[model samples]
Target: MEEEKRRLIMYEKLMAEIDLGIHAIDDSGKTVIYNQKISDIENMNPQEVLHKPVREVFKFNEGQGSTLHRAMTEGYDFRDEKQTYFNNKGVEITTVNNTFPVMHHGEVIGALEVTKDITRLKRLVQENMNNGTRRYRFQDIIGRSEPLEEVIEHAKRATRTNSSVLIVGETGTGKELFAQSIHNESSRSAGPFVSQNCAALPESLIEGILFGTAKGAFTGAENRPGLFEQAEGGTLLLDEMNSLSPDLQSKLLRVIQEKTVRRVGDTKERKIDIRLLATMNEDPVDAITNGRLRKDLYYRLSVVSLFVPPLRERMEDLAPLSEYFISKYNDLFQLEVEGISTEVRKLLASYHWPGNIRELEHVIEGAMNLITEEKYIEFTHLPLQFKRKRPRPPEHNEIFHEEESTPLLKDYLFQQEKTFMQRVLKEHNYRVQETAAAIGISRQSLQYRMKKLGIQKIRE
Candidate 1:
């Protein structure tokens, strides 16, 4: 009898030490074990709860569902089921419960419930739901060019509201950085800042990802929240928005207008409240003309549009941006590098950085990795591609070489036309609508000529 008492005391002590709330009920719905954790979680006295009817102790409304009651009567089990309701003291609580039916001799005799208080966690979820964290601020963006300054100023003003913002720029132009900065400056800064790149995702899965999936909607589909729902009361950045399919674009427009989303294969709409920031490497007009983007959606998203200038247009910022990258990499690599060679700077300035800021950062990082105990980045340390000299302009004599045979008029005219088209396309950063507008032609006509002349579109 002494040994049995010691064992009972040890069991009670073990139950008291557990963090999870444990509540048990016998076949008559009378409480059998109500651990200290359960008492604390429910804010009730153990003496007041002991041997009481389970439904009465929990204050379960008549005809309302209760997991422990279900387990006791139906002999079923539930795991990780989330329940939210007001307690006896009128305090709202959210909890995840795992209930199991106790069986003896092939008959259910009682039930045991394990619960975890998730009220604080659910509050956090409602406030911020980004998968990870955002680490960018306005000060992190380094630039001084006029166009860049204009973009930065516009972006700062966009943080004042929950309205949608559309950012247009070429690849490597720091679109995502701008998005993060805006989110950090907004009222929703404490909330989540989620981002998704439409171009990086497969076409078939984009819809399900942005919306959500209802249980039994498809193979392996469960009742899951989507980016929009997850970003409730926060910010959602949709990068490369132009790459989304037309069907998806239409649905996106509806969501933006109604502030509600219907999960895939689910008929009911779930309302959401979130700020939107979308980025596109191509011109929105081009996307519309090509039927790749919906016009209404573009208009809705462009409530406040900001455009980041390309590196070639913002050459003045190259030096500052390079210096910034150098300083960043120095800390990252634990290097004492101070500056770059004059020749290296000249080379960087002269060469058009087709990849913009991202490419510049890569070049600096690669050079930093190669340098050891060097005070400065030398010309030799530069990438081989950047080391190559730019092709010199053709001399007057070379253009009209006396020794070379004169070209045919048709060939000469065709070459001139192709060269002009290529220059215009490059000036517009290969954006179809902008190139067409600049070259005084329709998008369709330019596309046809590009196809006929074998001029390939440059990838952003």
Candidate 2:
């Protein structure tokens, strides 16, 4: 009996430490029990709430009905963020709330409530609306394309709401670039942007990276702010959030809910104010299925989801992109090469670019360095193994000999002419000018054919 009493006492203490704003409404619609979070949100003490009518305590409307009462009578779960009418202050407060019916054995007895304050978010939203333009908008995104335009548009929407974001794509797809653009366009743009990669940093170092420790917290310790601290009043990006263990995901969930972080070897929790963005190379759902990514963490991140398209899908930017990279590398590598050979473009377009834009950039830089020329790049300047040959057209010498000017078949000759052009490109190693000159065509005309054939490499 003594042990049971002691265990009961410990269990009650455990319930008191819960961070969620737990509330209990009896069948009579009176507040029977409330947790610290609820007390703080309602600006009332537990004693004041013990038996007060919920309507009087919360000043809820009798006609519209309380979400809590609805949950109890209907035995349905209620959850959402809404503007709730206040009695004491006569003002509305936006609350992230969850209400569920409480039952003993199999019988419903009351309803439990959990509420969180989002008033600060409201102010930030209002200020942004009045300004008519955010400090960080989509214009900051450097790319111009249908996909990129859509991505920037979503980033703008994400800033208006304080929901977490998850960016999923392959490596070198500019995940971090997009992540930063989102942050810069968000309400927290003025604050520092802290970025960390779970795959880059080991688990042993992740905790310290997230929650800073004191000077003596560990052996070689110096008082340093973790990424979270640096990102306070700004944004923190975990580039590989799925790499975190299940344990870290739980800790992260607490931080998201409470907006606080406690340093290692510390006794008190420190508050943090920042937005969060995480990235992944794989589907978050798959990660969860395999136990690599936490489901709760996935839920938190997927509130605002954006997937960057692979470069192969954005072929419209190929030529301009090649030019862009050429110009960029021209300054970086100190080269005067105008651009890649026409054949080089065809060669690039023919190969399956699995590596995406990043791969294209590297190839351009590689070819530029190998050329060592000032005028124009040659087909041989590109990676040779990637070049593929086009089939040659059979000579129609019999027809040419049939008459001096046998009825000139235009489109048929054009088809044969186009095929001949492709063969010429292969011969010149896909160098545009070389292929054009060989086919008695100009570089511009060749470019038009390449574009017409939907041939592109190194998408812009």
Candidate 3:
């Protein structure tokens, strides 16, 4: 008898320490056990709820009552049901509950309920939905290269209809730019435009955030509209769509097919009138082959696909892009910078920009910050990361000269020209225009000669 009493005490201690809210009642609907978690969730003291009838301690909405009461009296089990009720103090509480009937020899003895509080999560989702806005449009995209223009044309076509779009590009290739441009150009321009990075949140939370939550979808889930509902009558850009789990990808495919969404843990489905745009940083074929993406979902989202070309593929746009960034910073920094020097342009063109336009913009921005009274961005102004990748110019002592045999006239002339240009540039403190004036040649002529002779200003 003492052992049984000890075991009962141990059980009570474990119940109190459990993370979930636990509430149990007798067949008569009177509370027999009320744990601390439930007390916290309901904002009620255990003393206030213990031994009290559930109907008297809490008030449910019309047509809804206690899940524990129904489970005990009706001998039924309720799984993942959302319940909202007011405590005796009139504070409203929302919970996701799993209520089960406790049976003794096939007869209902009582009921047990396990619950999770999600009131805060619900409030946050509502606040986020109310605050989001779209800022990018087609004109905001900068490049004029054929590869960029071709994709823009396709994106424009995407705006004419409500077809799902899959935008494929490398990181920093501006996939979201096209997605926003499509929305702003389309008939849904007046409505909300929402974007969610699939990789931004964990799988468990993302499901509820994307599809919305029904008051009791899961622990901490509140009845709130997801990204789909928030972007109603407009566009929803799912950036890095391939990052989504396969199960979610399947659900997304279903939503695309049916044009409807069912909130997490809710039985009813609501029709959504929103355009879907998804982006992938990697090739969809590779993503599918590696099992990171679903083939069916890929097919669904690719109805009007676009590939934003990397910066390396469109070298012609470099000059214009650089000029644009220069002008942008000139206004922003309140400076009078003219343009990039020829050598700086050469260095910018030679390196392969792995981060694409974004990297180029950062390089320009970094250079802009270092500018004081300089008229143009020079080779010295470029970032060290860029300089490290390119071959460093040979130092004066490192320049090789023929010693064993007489050199060819072309080779000897090349050496002489390189040596002369290096000396003149050093004298002018590596100023291109000043060096050109000292040599009695046009600035463009001196620049061309320097390029041919492999002459570059060495950093001091």
What are the per-model numbers of colliding residue pairs?
0, 8, 0
Overall local distance difference test of candidate 2: 0.69
lDDT of 1 by residue, 93-185 (tens): 767788999999999999999988756434433433544475798898888887788788989998898889998888999999999999899
Please give the lDDT score at residue 44 for candidate 1. Answer: 78
* Cα lDDT tens digits for candidate 3, 1-460: 6999999999989988998899999988889988998999999989999998999989999999899999988888998888889999898888888999999999999999999876645654665565446578888888788778878998998889988998988888889899989998999898888887778666767888889888755555557788898889988889899998889999998998999999999999999999999999985655877999987888788887787877766777888888899999999999999999987876677655778888989999988888999999987887777776632122221223333334445346657888888988988888988888888876755764654454665642
| Tens-digit lDDT track of model 2 for 1-460 | 6999999888678668876667789988888878777667667668877887777766664466677888899999986635365746565555667788998898889898777655533443243233312333355434577766666677667777668899977676678777777777667777777777777655766677678776656533346566677777877888888888899899989888888888776767888888889999875555776999887777777888877765655655667778888888889878887776666665565443557778778777777777665556677666554344321122322222333333235324646656766666677777777767887755654664554333442221
Superposition-based RMSD of candidate 1 using all C-alpha atoms, in angstroms: 14.9
List residue ranges in candidate 3 displaced over 4 A: 1-132, 391-460
Model 1 has a clash total of 0
How are the candidates ranked when ordered by lDDT, highest leading? 3, 1, 2
Give candidates' CA RMSD values in order: 14.9, 23.5, 16.1
- Tell how far residue 7 is off in model 1, in angstroms: 68
Q: Local error of candidate 2 at 102, Å?
A: 68
Per-candidate TM-scores read 0.59, 0.53, 0.59
Candidate 2 Cα outliers beyond 4 Å, as residue runs = 1-143, 384-460
